[model samples]
Target: MDTASLKKEIIAYSKTIGIDKIGFASPSTFEEMKVRLYRQQELRYQSGFEEKDIEKRTEPSLIFDKPKSIISIALAYPSKMGPKVISKKGERRGIFSRASWGTDYHTVLRDRLKKLEEYIALKMPEARFKSMVDTGELVDRAVAERAGIGWSGKNCSIITPEFGSYVYLGEMITNIPFEPDHPMEDRCGSCNKCVDVCPTGALVQGGQLNAQKCIAFVTQTKGFLAEEFREKLGNRLYGCDTCQTVCPENKGKDFHFHTEMEPNPEIAKPLLKPLLSISNREFKEKFGHVSGSWRGKKPIQRNAIIALAHYRDETAIPELITVMKDDPRPVLRGTAAWALGKIGGQDALEALQHAFSVEKDEEVLQEIRKGLYFFAEKKQG
Candidate 1:
């Protein structure tokens, strides 16, 4: 295909395939990016992705054996639900993440990509194409930026002008040579709202994130919540959307991308009471397919207990007592004890003592005391 015609056909085909944005990138930029990536990883900024694989990620040969061009795609996750409503939907009334409030994007994006691939295959049967959606070792964010979609924001999320940082990215690496698009100019000149609003200070001052400090990462992590950070978590049952909410660039751009009329009010803003009483079967029935459900019912349940403590609502004491003993997971049991203590009062203190005897680990003992002190101070009252 001639350069002019190929670019036209690719752009036309990309829109037809349902991708919001499309761009081509020359293979050479991939090689240059590899070098820069190594330095970034050495500095400990890359999100816990295995840095040892950096060499393979930069190698164009690895991405496409005979690669000459890259086709980048963007899918927007615009939801009308405001930040406060979206975050609490699942556990409050019990719903899903705003992104998962509608159909799962994985299936939606893939179906569209399949159509793009079939068209390319028919156009040139000898040509080959491989598509990935947040799958594979390629530096996807870097590729998308180079492909001229958007620049990486201070929160480390790609920020598109039209959709802000709410767009999901995917790509198709191909052997077909297509004209490359110019990278977009960085527009986040001096904005730092995303950095300042981060609950755990994960977003650094200069557009990078320390993922370990990220509340989103910690919430999704399997296993125990560290003793030090437990109190800092607050009521976030799933991913923390604080950074995105604070971005000035995202203001007034309401684009809810679903046919659904409005967010399910039940999950949008719950009172942190019913979730503590949710049975495993009920938890599954409510949140199983949602994005936050992947960590299973345990983490969400554990978070609910923590939120009760953070909120300091004594009404949750009875429920907390039940979770402190009968909850199957020891970490949940331990957190429940800690939460109970934070709620204070005689009942909460007695439950902590009971939990302390059952808990063998010294770490849990420390948390138990932290909760117990609330009553110890109150006893002096």
Candidate 2:
């Protein structure tokens, strides 16, 4: 088995599989990353992650055994794709963040990487290797930078010259002695577009990010949002792409290329009315393939209400009033009340008053009364 010949074939195979970039690095390149993970854990940034993530990420053996090289792969995520017509009365711009505009990358990349592994094994039957995506222990973005896949931007996302920061990263750890690639130079010089445009103030100075305050992370988080952060959520139902959209690297890029990944017309830009009234089974059938569907229908439905409230879309008020009374999830009921307040109309106010009278939970009833007060006050003024 000629190891050199196999290495060359692997790279060629990866490109053929649709990966935009591939590079190599020594496993030792991630020493600093292990330390930073500990610091982030102490600071409570990774509270949701199990302790195993912290432990395994630091294990040199876990990523590779007697490893001599690392391979990092990048897949270009189409950042723009949506409808052409805009309604003058209600334009809910149902744009997909570059990452979501295609079939989910997890399956696509995994299938490719697994094939690459099989190729390597055939060439060197005794070789050792493992592959992983975003779900892995080792910080994918950090390894990506070391492998020269791209530079870590101020937004803390991996950015390539061709794909900007709108790309997904995956990796393979192997014991083969392949030559590592050079890293990309930092091109984000004097650029603060991503930070300046953030609605949640999650990005700090020097390119550090606090995920707790990130709108993307918050939207995906389970349970209800705090009162203070509710209104700031705006009309974002799933993930927030505000920071990435404003990036200079992503700006002016052509969108006419490939954008077939946009959601179904009705599903892509969901109607507030239907979202507020759907059964759990219907929600699953519609959004099951998308990232937003993972946390189940409750959080998204809750976010839809929040977004409706922020947009002040009074047209959705009738449905909002309906959900306010019958939503199985208390969180959804609470958020619907808030939306009714924001979209105050005579019918919405009356619904809130009725809810307040029947509401048993103090916290939920408080939210209902809050909505009623605002609706009544708006009518008076």
- Ten residues in sequence with the least summed lDDT for candidate 1: 86-95
User: Which pairs in model 1 have colliding backbones?
Assistant: 89-267, 89-268, 90-94, 90-95, 92-270, 93-266
Best by lDDT: 2
Name the lDDT value of residue 234 in candidate 2.
70
Model 1 regions more than 4 Å off = 1-3, 29-52, 82-100, 258-274, 277-284, 379-381
- Model 1 lDDT, residue 9, Cα: 78
What is candidate 2's CA lDDT for residue 201? 81
Candidate 2 accuracy as TM-score: 0.91
In model 2, residue pairs whose N, Cα or C atoms come closer than 3 Å (at least 3 residues apart or on different chains), thus clashing, are: 78-98, 79-98
Clashes of each: 6, 2
